[model samples]
Target: MSSILRELGALVIDADLLAREVVAPGTPGLAALVEEFGPGVLTPDGELDRPAVASRVFGDEAARRTLEGIVHPRVYEEIQRLEAEAPPGAVVVHDIPLLAESGRADSFDAVVVVDAPLATQVERMVRDRGWSEDDARSRAAAQASREDRLAVATHVVENTGTREDLRRRVEEVWADLHAR
Candidate 1:
């Protein structure tokens, strides 16, 4: 969705990328994370050890909230900066994975959900990303359920098919965005 939106000349702000930026080495966000999670969150070289942080927070709601408290404000600041800098009348697309989880569905003009079955998600995570099956299932379960996401979605792009099918659906979505 982000790629297609970018191709159509929208200013795309990827939340995942922004998350990384906010916590990069030497940033206040990183300092806060280290303070909260201890030095173990950093690599020996002083870079943020993302996997370590993930391991620490993944199943712990309190730890996750602590991390979010440190990171989200910074990400939001950057998003606001980019949005302000965009040309007038430009379409700004923010690819935020946790829109539903964050209760932010109303923040955007429309919500586009790229969805697949839980089994397919787990399989892709295990096969394509080398995640353990249990780890993949746990991560998926942590997010908003399919029904919850669908209820908030203004548009749904089924990702249960081939790359060509995804491309076609993206094109259709691009056209619809333009029409609106």
Candidate 2:
């Protein structure tokens, strides 16, 4: 969706990408995680061991909260800097995965959720990302509920079908955003 939006001339600020930056080696976010969860979460070369960290945090609420505490603020700060740097009146889209969970759904002019059912999400994660089914399911379960996401969504792009279908849905949503 973000890729499509970028092609369509929206300045899309991807929080997932920013999340990676905030926790890159030598960053304070990584330091905090190492302090809280220990050096085991780091690779031998000193980059974050993402899979190890995900395996630790996804199942445990406290661990997830700890990870968020170290990461979200840094991501937010980068997002603010990026938004400020966008062109005047540009159609900037903040592609945030945790808008509902972070209590910032109401902050956007329009919330476009690229929603898929749990089975669809799980299947794609397993097939495309090479994650085990249970791991995919568990990761999906950790996020905001489908209903909660829908409640905040001003537009919903259903991603249950093929890539072409997703592109079409995204295009329609893109049109709606332009209309607004």
**Which has the greatest lDDT?**
2
Q: What lDDT does the true structure give each of the candidates?
A: 0.88, 0.92
Name the regions of candidate 1 deviating beyond 4 angstroms.
none
| Residue-wise C-alpha lDDT for candidate 1, range 47-123, written one tens digit per residue | 89988987888899898888888888899899899999999878788899888888879988888899999999999
lDDT of 2 by residue, 61-108 (tens): 999998999899999999999999999868889999989899998888
The true-versus-predicted C-alpha distance at residue 151 of model 1, in Å, is 1.2
Superposed Cα deviation of residue 54, candidate 1 (Å): 1.0
Q: How accurate locally is residue 70 in candidate 2, as Cα lDDT from 0 to 100?
A: 89
Task: Report the Cα RMSD per candidate.
Answer: 1.1, 1.1
Clashing pairs in 2: none
